[model samples]
Target: MTSIPPTDFRSFLSSVGRVFAVFFRQGRKARRTRFFFLFSFLPVAVSLVIKFNQVFSGKPGREGGYLFTNLIMLFYLQMIILILALFYGTSVCSEELEGKTLAYLITRPIPKAAIVLGKYAAYMAVMTGMVILGLIFSFFVLNVDRLLDPSLYGLLGRYLGVLILGLMAYGAFFTFLGSSLKRSIFFGLLFSFGWENVIQYFPGSTQRLAIAHYLKSFLPATSSGRFSFLTFRLEPTKPGLALLMLFAIAAAFLALACLFFSKKEYSLED
Candidate 1:
């Protein structure tokens, strides 16, 4: 197989580093954009409210624990990842265009692939931090007693792993959308809430095309009657295959983003 020259590889690495550094310094833009920080904090806030009400009402603790975990892990946590990934991923390159900085960024001594990939890396890093903080807040606000249980911590770790996998997949897909489409957010929303939500319920191989299909396969099976509406009939995929699917999806989308970015022209006029 042909291999890249060492000098070329080193230059690509350096370009990646430079792009990462610039975006890393500008990471605060994520929080400032349309009150994203508040949206990120929302899961914890709702959990806290529920926890306090349970304590004040002297409700039974067992049921409350279940509610906290479900809300944090299934509802709030997933919502945060989906929403933030869509917003951040779809805006990564578009923001530069909006700020009239695309010309400056593109003119730099960097490979086009490095520019797209670097912004992708920076976006993932920022999302990772936000998701971790949200998880921690939900954990503590639910109750400090959970920290005493080693099994609970182990479970949380697994759940976090699944969430991160989902983030990487969804983030890359939306980033590809942003790079390729002018009205990406609108379509992204449709895919997340409309297509991903409904298509899994379809019969046969048709459902497999959606990202959420693989994600659901990675989650521990639940007899959550409260969320029966969200359940779809499908054989669970092995964890290894599910993880691989997410990685493959992310790689494919990011590669497409790089290809599109390299070919498309950006301008202040648009």
Candidate 2:
């Protein structure tokens, strides 16, 4: 049974803690969880294929850094991160609405913001765990020979940091949309696949409007060294600016999501 806590700072924290644990355990049994676990390892398959092909051609060497930057990073930053954020992030509220459980949720004594905050934190933990495990295994497959190199670990650390920031920003933005918009999934697809992909490649400062632009700023290089022109970045945002902008985006969206969730009324029929 759900705990009924009075609205206060301590009660709010208690609400968030309880909901976090409950939702986290629920998420484990979710089909989305299984999908993410499987999706995370997809890159490992590609890594093996590439490694075998390189070895057969007599061009194999410990080029994990280059391979990651040129090939795998694109698969990750452009595709995997976006998919994860969109699928899981938007589900925070959408799932409740679809399951017809939001009514029961809001009627409880717990603060509404706590529901959003708790669920967001729970999803973050799940996404992070899946992403970290998948990315680490993928990196291992790519850099099998360089596991002892200290620099390799640093590279992995930087990559993880950048990707996590991407998840946080994208996830929060989608969570806000999910709570506010009726057709958030449609808009999310447009935003993720349409706006993000195209805007980053646009000419001039217009490209700066894209979240991908800021993300690419922190990436050491573009998609592929040879075909880098495909996803070129003429003037990437500064690392400091990227950090600021991403954090600001996440915080702003989360605040909006919480506010909207707290105030908006939903009917059982709607």
Model 2 scores a TM of: 0.91
Off by over 4 Å in 2: 1-7, 222-224, 227-231
Q: lDDT tens digits, residues 129-223, model 2?
A: 88888788879888887789898888888888888998999999999988888778999999999999888888899998888887778866554
lDDT of 2 at 150: 94
- Candidate with top TM-score is 1
lDDT of each: 0.77, 0.83
Error of 2 at 154 (Å): 1.1
All candidates: TM-score: 0.91, 0.91
lDDT tens digits, residues 1-270, model 1? 999999999999999988888886677574563376667778788888877887888875545346555666666434778888898888777777777878887888898889888888887888877787777787777766556767667666776787788889999999999898888999999988898877877767777787777777765565665653344475566778888989999999999999989998876685
* True-structure RMSD, every candidate: 2.1, 4.2
Model 1 error, position 261 (Å) = 0.5
Q: How big is the RMSD of model 2?
A: 4.2
**Residue pairs in collision within model 2:** none
